[model samples]
Every structure is written in C-alpha cells, then in structure tokens.
Target: MSRTSRTRLRLVGALTGALLAVVAADPAAQAHCDDPPTLADLAQRHGRYFGSATDNPELTDTAYTKILGSEFDMITPGNGMKWYATEPQQGVFDWTAGDAIVDLARAHHQKVRAHTLVWHSQLPGWLTGKEWTADALRAVLKKHIQTEVRHYRGKVYSWDVVNEAFNEDGTYRETVFYKTLGPGYIADALRWAHQADPKAKLYLNDYNIEAVGPKSDAYYGLAKELKAQGVPLDGVGLQAHLALQYGYPTTLEDNLRRFARLGLDTALTEVDVRMLLPATEEKLAQQADWYRDMTEACLAVRRCVGITIWDHNVG
Candidate 1:
C-alpha cells in the first residue's frame, strides 16, 4: 500500500461532537506547587523536548494547550487513543478525542506522538475471542493501522508501532500480537504503518529496558536485528517507568549509548520516577535532578532524540 493510497483511504472528522465538561480544580484541592515549570519552558532551557500524556478525553480545558505554549514540543494522549479505547468493538471506530489531541497540537504548532498502535494490554474483548486465527487477526491489525495512521497522515510525528514484546529471558512475551501473528508481527506492523504514513516516524516502545541487563539486551539485540533486516522501524521508545524503591539503573548511560549505537533514534517515552507514597518536597526536587540528568544523557548521545516526562506535576 503506497502512502498516497493509504492517505486517500483515511477519514477525518470534527472532534467537537464528543464535547466533555470542563475540569475544575476542587477549591479544597491542594495546589501541588506554587509554580511548576511548563514543559516547553523546560525543553527550551535543557535544549530538549518535554511533554506528557494527559488523561483527558474531551480535551476541552486549556491544560494541553498551556503546556504546548510553555515550550513542550510534543503531546501523547496515552491510552485515550489506544486500540481498545479508540475502537473497542470490531469495525466501530471512534476518533473524537484523538482528533482533538492532534488538532490541539497542530494549533499550538507542536508535534503529536501517537501513544501506541499495538499492545497486549487494553485490547477489546471482541478481538480476544476464542475463534481468533492468524489470518483473521492479520487482516484486523492491518486495517486498524492503515485507518488510524492514514487518518492522522502527516500530523503524528511518530507511532509506537509495537510495544513491550520481550520478556526477561530474551524470549518473546506470550501476548496476543505475538501468539496470533507470531514473531513476524513486529515487522508486519512497522511495514503497514510505514505504508500508511511514510514520512511519520515509527518506534518500538517498552518498559524495563533502561538497564544494561537481560531485558535491555534483548531489546537492543532485537532492534539491531530489525534494522539489519531492513525493517521500516524508525526509532526506539524507552518507557523509563522508574521506581524509587528499587533505585534507578546504575548503567543507564551505558544502556542508552548501546541502543544509540544501533543507529536508531530513541526517546524517553513514559518518564516518571515514582515512590511508594506521596512525594515529599525533597523527593520532588531530587526527581527533577534525576530528570535533568536523564535529559543530559539524551543530549550526550547523537541518536537519543529527546526526553518526555510522563507527567509534569511531579510534586
């Protein structure tokens, strides 16, 4: 499928139809911070991009736009645009909220990175039925990618075409995508999405791949193999779902450098350093420093694209 044909097969619609109520901060809701740095502002100072995935459907408020104005160059709507969320039932597609996110990004002159195209989680109940076969599943996957990517066309900067596909042992996870479509699923997804929007970047995103261990090695090796085989994969997404309890990776820089050496672009997809309980003032500032260091690491590597904070309200 040529990109031109795929673009022509797409459908665009007005997002104003699914209007949502404006969110109001509770009068008693504690202000997290007296003044927090806007994503754009942080990006400009650090010489990198900063952004987040908002949990809003209507997008009627000024939050996303405000972040864009502050220096954030990207916006990902998270699960709001996932497979199940967008088209829960077979053949019934909805693009109201997704369209709003892209439109808002365009209005702000910011880039929009689509959260994901395929994943084991958040799959609709219908797609996971008993009679699901490889052929039937392949058709569904291709159609979904073509439709979604074509709808956005040149709007989306990149798509996480395949998320979390490997386990700790360097073997493929038993996800429906892998189980139904086999290991070729990843390559097939990239090809389809690339055919849909050739100019847009495509990435493979996953968590727990930030360390220089079995998991990270598996991902690094897989990415190298894919690129070597001429896969249309354009980039890699490091979810960076960090935890304070286990402590951060000691060889974080080494892991990132290894991936960058694979000759593919990389981005910090879901960056949030979380503790068990509410964050303290000290923890917030410490987390910010960690974030600064993470951005510094990205800047150090030529292939490290940018850093995207999953959320701005660290406090």
Candidate 2:
C-alpha cells in the first residue's frame, strides 16, 4: 500500500484503539524501540535531543507520556495543529488543537516546535484569491504570521518560518507565495516571524535536501544569502524522509557539515523509513541500517540539534 493508504489505516486503528492503552511503561522497549539501537538511547547518547509527532486524543496517555517523558525532549503535533486545523476561516482563528499540543509539550517540559507559519500548502480557501495583488497578499501574509506567532510567543522553541520555497533544480518553485511576493517573500516571512516572536528561533524547512546536490546546494546558498542579508533565520531544517528500499544518502554528513559551516543550527525533521509494500528480511535490515546512518550523522554534527520522525509507524 502507498503511504497515504497506510496513514489512513493507522488513523483508523488509532481512533479505534484510543481507549486501549499499552500497559508497558518501559520507554526504552516500546514498539518503535524494539530494535537494539532504540531512538531513545540514541538520542540520550548523542544529545539530550529526541522528539516525535503525535495526534492521539489522549494527549496524556500512559504510553505516550512514558515515551515522551523518558525519550523526547521536543514534541511536534504532526498535522493536527496547522493552518487548516487552527484557522479554517479568514479572520476567525481557532486555537483548540494547537493550544492542546502546546499545553502537552509544556506539561512534559518538552520543547515545542511549531511548524509552517507560512507555506503554499494547507492554506485555507479564503486566502487563495488569484485576484489579490502582491501588496494585498503581503498584508494577508503578515497578519497570518504575526497573529499566530505572537499567540505562541515564548512557547514555541522554533518555527518553520518558510517551507519548501525552492525546487529540486535550484530555482524557486512557482508557489502562490512566490508568484505574488516574489523570492523576497521568504526573507519577508522570516522578518515578520522574528518581529512576532523575537525570542523564538526561526527555521527554513525543506525536503530532499539531505544530500549535497542541486537541491541541497540551492537551500544552502539561500540560507547563506539570508544570513548575509541579516534575515532572522535561526536554523535550517532538513526533512529527512528516507527510504528502506533503494538506499538513503550516505553523504548526509557532508550535507549537515555544509549547513553548519553557514553558522546555523540544523535539525533532522520529518524522518521516516518507509517500506509499505511487501518487505523482505534484507529490506528490513536495510531499513535498520538507514536509521542507524541517519542517527549517526545527526549525532556527529555538533550543530545538529534534533531528529524527529514524521509519523512513528508508516503502516
């Protein structure tokens, strides 16, 4: 099955099993940690930096609380708390889901990472006007960032101020944000986010930039330029979505090193080793090796702060 289908099945299972709490409190030997090199142990050994994405209704469940308490120092609410879930209407902002996530993180003394203050994806219909000129669109964007960031001020440890602005070939994707506000929109978004919460660390997040290639070079160059231009970008987030089949990039260390040379903190966000279709024993072993390499790479980098998987279980 595809990842989407797998995700749907998991969601259904989660909803049904919401009441069935896992009795085991052994955070070091949980389902995802059954392997020898548990993510919990790896994180504790590397840095005190470990995190996970969760959206269960029982935010304070035994299993979750146990794992989070022992293993995770940071927590991201996956997609349960983003623009669409928080603000479905134009000016009517709802803080139900996101606020719950913040509260849970705070309760556990975990650092909260707020994703995607500005992105072309998951935008509400009200903000999708084709007629709005650049100036008008700028006004809307500013309000969106300011309102949301200010509300979560002092709460969020880092915010993905801008996400996936560049294509795989070192060029800006023709996103609505780009079309209306031009490439400057990224810098503008960072500035706006900084103004909203000066203390919050702002990051630029993108996928497929884990290796030193055209896409990686594009992100690195942009980050260097942003730093030079005095943009308030605090970190660079590498969304490490790896596969267990073909092979993950072995050049991840070089990639992280290059980003670190730019004097910015790095994070391995949204990591997962997918093997949804049939899997052989060799494939599973390869998957384990993939996870090991990623962990080792992140651990090696002094500037690499944390590594978070997108979803704990793909299928």
lDDT of 1 at 124: 89
Candidate 1 per-residue lDDT, tens place, 14-118, comes to 000101001012232123224544444434443556666655542554553464445467877766678987888888888877887787778877788897888
TM-score of 1: 0.82
Q: Once superposed on the true structure, which residue ranges of model 1 sit more than 4 Å away at CA? A: 1-47, 63-65
Candidate closest to the true structure, highest lDDT:
2
lDDT of model 2 at position 56? 44
Q: Provide the clashing-pair count of each candidate structure.
A: 4, 0
Model 2 steric clash pairs = none
Candidate that scores best on TM-score: 2
- Model 2 is weakest, by summed lDDT over 10 consecutive residues, at 14-23
lDDT at position 280, candidate 1: 77
Give the alpha-carbon lDDT of every model: 0.71, 0.73
